[model samples]
Target: MMILKLLAPIILFAIAILQGLFAEKINKIKWLKITLICLLLGSLTVGLIIISLDEKNANNFSKQQKDNIDSLRIENAQLKNNLDSLHRALTKGMDDRSLQEIELNKKVSELNIKLEPFVKLALTKYPAYDLQSALNKIAQDIENAKKLAEPPILIPNAQEISRDKTGLNMLLQFKLSKNQSLGQIIFYAEIEDGSTAKIVEFWPSTKGGAFNSGPDSKMIAPDGKSSRLIYSLIGAGNPTFDLKVTKAVTVRITSNYLPEPFITKIE
Candidate 1:
């Protein structure tokens, strides 16, 4: 713009001199006006051309921006769809888990009801016994009850037993840490008296104390921690010189590890 301004005055002076010398015959004023008017017209034409090119570039820039926006919208839509699909999958998994839990609970309820009779028999006859052994008996019965309850699968194994330090008496026990998740389980056991028969007792080992034979499931003993149950059977004070040994009792220890729940008689 400065170069144009500098050249405009010089071009005007030359044109004016030429007009004054040739057409006006030394009329300088009229020739100067014509020269200035010519310069003004040339400046106007150049300015208009620049303005037109700027407007064309602006239109092209606007079109490119619209295309970029359209592409971004498509990508955004696809992302939203993927998120929705994942949400649906997560919700479905939670629903399936709840249904399975309900079914499992129902089956357990039915099994407990079917085993009620056996449970009462043990409670009445072996008033004194071990809780752990009772649980083991239940496991055994479950295996045995398979013929009656065919719908469920019960893994059968030989009853477990633990011998005492003297090797004459036995200890019995079972763990619910594995079966605890099942909530509750009921069991039963028996001591058959024969030509060789004996007497035994039972007690519960829980967050409670040893079998003081004083209370049911909720008793806590003097020990700081819960006691494992120990059931015992000692010889009846008198021994006869009979040739035939008539006193004997066959006891199935819950598992060899568990001993009967007993302590010095409270009496």
Candidate 2:
């Protein structure tokens, strides 16, 4: 259709040229010459109209193509922005999961440290087939131990407190159920003579080193069923006191993965 429109103008113009040439040849026939000249002018006018209409149609087509291209570019830009946003969301999710995995691993390590004593005892005393059963029993016993109102340990007394000639020393004993472990301990002491003994620190023995207090400490609980902790105290220069003068001792004890601390007072 486009080709036919373009050709139509040229065909009309050609016919007009042919008619003008033929009219000159028939100059002798005056009426026929006039008719041929009129035909020539009419064809020329029609050709001009066809050319103008075709040019206008071409311009409209070009404008419509430009508008379509602009719409396509807008859609492409929107798609690219959506893809970028999705990528950012996925990256953030992965980073969050990584952090959660690290925290879970830390908790698992702490649990293993707390349970090491029980696992070892079970392996030594029970056969391989009965090891799991032994661990279950140990866990049950520890739960039962936690339910007791009184602490399952002997409070420190002047007779039980060992003294160092150079410094004040107080020792307390804890007799735990089989495979039970210890978590945290804090102490408060009072003297009968109303004197204060400045304490440096108190700690339990794990293996051969002092047990540190904190979440990071991975020290295994005391082996076997009994454990002891000692407190070292300082005094003014050479202050000394008779053991009989020792009055009250209070302790806050936390044991074996328990969530709360237990306060025990000995008089």
Candidate 3:
């Protein structure tokens, strides 16, 4: 169709040139003029056919391009809808996590409130027992509950300590100068009967002098074992023991608010 369209105009022009060349002879010959006129009419017919076919083909190409564009737009819309759905899912997950954390904190606070009286009674009545250790156990249980409530992907490793364990497994020895001695000792105590132990008083056995009272110093290990260190200044009228003495120094730790004491030897 396109080739015919291009050739139609050239053919018509050539026919006109031939007619002009035969103009003088046409007065002598009627058949030649008639043949030229017929040729011209045939060229016009061919040109009209070529124009009609070209327009039809052009309309078909335009329709195909429009269909392809519509398909691309539909696919793009579907992709956009999928992306929006994914974003909404992610937002919902975050909101759920936030609510879980809020509930967990509330439960922990309530547990602490309920355990306060028991903890106080244990501390007051059984100074030999470690009430703080029991409290720590309660805190750990709350933490474990919170962990269970969390998503599997966000859960952490267990942090609870064993019941059989007491103070830090590691040893700590301090060398004292003449002016200072063991003062206050804070430690995580584990009792064999499952009773909590507390340090009420510390004293030197030989001199009947009390250790200096102050804030507790705690030492903790990676495995959750811990102990405390206490030191004291020599009191008036109390005999000063030589730090270089080869003999072990005996110290008594009184608990349960009782006059009876437990003894520990330090070398």
Best by TM-score: 2
Model 1 per-residue lDDT tens digits across residues 152-174: 21122212333333222222333
Ten residues in a row with the worst lDDT in model 2? 236-245
- At residue 79, give the lDDT of candidate 1: 91
The parts of candidate 1 lying over 4 Å away from their true place are 1-42, 138-267
Q: How many clashing residue pairs are found in candidate 1?
A: 26
**Tens-digit lDDT track of model 3 for 79-198:** 999999999999999999999999999999999899788788656665675878766665676788886654321111111111212221112222222233333333232122222332
Model 2 C-alpha lDDT per residue in residues 77-181, reported as the tens digit of each score: 999999999999999999999999999999999999998988988767665537789898777777877766443333222224444444444444443333223
lDDT score, candidate 1, position 116? 76
Q: Report the number of the highest-lDDT candidate.
A: 2
Reference-based lDDT, each prediction: 0.43, 0.51, 0.49
lDDT of 2: 0.51
User: What is residue 127's positional error in candidate 1, in angstroms?
Assistant: 3.5
Model 3 C-alpha lDDT versus the unseen true structure: 0.49
Q: Tell me the deviation in Å of residue 247 in model 2.
A: 51
- Superpose all Cα atoms of candidate 3 onto the true structure and report the RMSD in Å to 1 decimal: 19.1
